[model samples]
Target: MIPARLAAAALAAAALAVLPAAAARAEVEVDPTRYAALGDSYSSGTGTGDYFDETCLRSNRAYPQLLANGLGAELAFAACSGATTSDLLSKQLGSLDAETDLVTVTIGGNDIGWAEAVTACITPLTDCMDEIEASETLVEEHLPGLLDGAYGAITNRAPNAAVYVLGYPRLFNGERTCGALKQPNVAEQVRMNQAADRLAEVLQGKAEEHGFTYVDVRDAFAGHAICDDVAYLNGLTYPPAESYHPNEMGHLNGYYPALSRAIA
Candidate 1:
């Protein structure tokens, strides 16, 4: 038999010894193998300097890859670049199942003809505002129902998964730094950012309606937009098609941190 004080001390030591193992078990309970990534260009890492596939442009630097690596989650599926909500319903939903525990999506930009709006802004004689407003009308009228259907399909497919609907960042830094022919003016850039904000709001509302999380990247990319001194978004690339997409730093610094925090 030991002294009462000594016995109490020994019990305390035993409890301390059990804590680390219990914590480790808790960590393992997360099931890292069940993650699936789905979305459009930003999620696919379009302008991130490297590609896993030419057509998909899936970059190893994308936020999904980063989160998967950090959490030791198996990235079982990833579809991005050029994918719209309709595309997601037709093609990407096949990747999710009841086993899927984690998912991230960034879409709807393509659905509203975001690329066309950008082209209109850069084209010599096109009315950029008119084009943008037309796109906004689509967002207001058509996009909600489309998003709801997409979200329903996703949740139906991956019944147990935690779905995160990520939104795009503003592409401009409220400045007119690029060539007049290559980029929109400061006023137009502001309007573009506002449109992006409106889209994000719509996405957030849809996500809430479907029991999913909405991750906003606008603030993260504020100082790193196309016209910034150290821009994270590509500004009128040689091919010109790469303009306004997030580069490597944008995905890593701008996207990854925000996603990590949200999942945490």
Candidate 2:
């Protein structure tokens, strides 16, 4: 309806108004660069690679590292095997500093101390439960204090980081195993997983109490639990090597997605 010259002038002005807004949107991108990880064997990729450390303490393929690889984030994947909540508060496993960007942690299974209890008493269910009961007593007695200390450490050091407390994945599925050893009795196995879940809950609450984010990985591995995947998880019946550790599939496929998003 308007003349061609008039219409063109109006269109040009509108276009100029929107161009600055578009440029602002493009400039408002998130640069997720810094990342750090802390935790136990579940996060450490204990048995996946041939890194060959004196102890099965750390692995190159740990979920945190996998996340780093997938996202191309600079990493400080300090996850270690046999880590406990207390270790988070100490310098035994690794170090923590002030400039960390993102922090992820997985632990508390060893607090239940199921390895020694189950390994030493695999033959007797009653004795295993008794040992677990005793360990539970010890853990319960000191668990809260240890968690408090850990939260204090992370908050004290990386006050600005987005710290995530990752939950442990279920280690066994029903009556499965690695070999000769029948694995921890099914009931005990359930108890152990439940204990780990409880520990995660405690850690999550504690982290929140200290201003950190907590990511629950238990529900994420629902169907893919050791019982469901015959090939993926290390079942006790197969053998006793990594009876309680995550299988390779568990480390790479199961946890990577759940954890990477948080870290990334």
Candidate 3:
């Protein structure tokens, strides 16, 4: 009964309305071809092996590279040894692409500069705990904001990318079995770990907000804890040449767990 012109117009209107619904219903494209990693020491395998460069910046042993290795994805690890959330955005990450299929980040460790802070307070566990605790106020104020921004930049830069934010591995000697190396107070380890937990939560929240994936490494490093049956770290007692970073075995333990969850 309707005129042909009116019928065409009605069909066009219906199409427009349906278009938005279809777009909303459309599944996100996830290709595991080209990938990139953005973050700091933990992801870069600082104490690990040669996954990338030569400097103290560490090597290709980085976990993100591990992820790439298993996924059969091409990788460009932009993860520096001491990267921050800000680094993820401002020329901070490199070799990225609009068509990148996957992206991962392991940032925020350097924000607290906990390595240096802990190194400075190594001789005084109570003081290190106190100093690290005081910095929480600052971390709470800024780390989330930085993560949110980093998430935005990552998604914006690569609209079709699948992003996965990784968490830091356990650093403290919970069982206090580092041989001659004095272990940190168990209470202090818990305190520092709480901060690390909060950091992972922040990154995970932002990743969820922006529709990216998150990989938590805490549980993965449990038995491999610095003082566990075997050891992951070389103990805080050794010089920079020996300690402060994950050993080769540490990277293997940390990387497989995180990469398994992400790639699977």
Candidate 4:
């Protein structure tokens, strides 16, 4: 009777072990089909050559739309052009909920006055480096705290979601090009791209602290930046506001592939 009892207990233990493995497999098998995209102009597809709304400037060619289509997920696209981190906290969080399974964010540019810096760079007689330095200071002093707040809110609203914080590509190719830029120099371009890199570093640190993914697109845009033969980013557009934003090809080829690979 003792031998028989020992055999039954061992069998029960083995069954329990198998149960956990089975449960893990079940969890892995569940598809992420409810996705929410929240961020600023880069995520909104501004300068992508098409717009859903003039105010928001979202494009069907945007990476978020492409990602949703590829994954067959139901999407709630809440990104908007010119939206800052504060705007995201106030306006975009409404699209997220407990049931959301995936999220992608691309903010912090406007918060650090990226547009203003570019404007300063383009205008003659203004010290572009000074403006750029001030923006960098803002990035160092305030951007991290803002990101923490935004990430905290996102996690609170959608606890189950896998969040991905996407970084910006370097706008210039580190070379002078034919396109007439107001700055018209490689040094300023390099400085601006370095500032962008710094911003990405801060954002990546925040994402890691919060257990979220950070997708870097810098390498992917290597030869396709603003000065490249086939430029992914727009130089100086008709509307000066559109300057320095990614064009349609940038969204399709650069952002889409980088994000798709990350999720896959």
- Best candidate, lDDT-wise? 4
Query: How do the candidates rank by TM-score, highest first?
Result: 1, 4, 3, 2
Question: Judged by TM-score relative to the true structure, which candidate is superior, 3 or 4?
Answer: 4
**Per-candidate TM-score against the hidden true structure:** 0.87, 0.75, 0.78, 0.86
Q: TM-score of the candidate numbered 4? A: 0.86
Candidate 1 per-residue lDDT over residues 28-133, each given as its tens digit: 2223346788988888888885688778888888888888888667786567688989889988988898877788898899999788888877676556898788
Would you give me the overall lDDT of model 3?
0.66
* lDDT: worst 10-residue window of model 1: 1-10
Better of 1 and 3 by TM-score: 1
Window of ten residues with lowest summed lDDT in model 2: 1-10
What does candidate 2 score on TM?
Answer: 0.75
Any runs in candidate 2 off by more than 4 Å, and if so which? 1-32, 52-56, 92-95, 124-126, 175-178, 236-241, 261-264
- What candidate 1 gets wrong by more than 4 Å, as runs, is 1-31, 180-182
Error of 4 at 173 (Å): 1.4
* Backbone clashes under 3 angstroms, per model: 0, 14, 6, 0
Tens digit per residue, CA lDDT, model 3, 1-264: 122322344465566666777674655433346778778777677776554475436566656666667765677877776666776677555566676767777777677657655664456533576667655655677777877787787777777666777776767755453545354667666677677677677767777877877787777777776667776765664336446666777677776566566655
Q: Give each model's whole-structure lDDT.
A: 0.81, 0.64, 0.66, 0.84
Q: Determine which window of 10 residues in candidate 4 has minimal summed lDDT.
A: 1-10
- Lowest summed lDDT over 10 consecutive residues: which window, candidate 3? 1-10
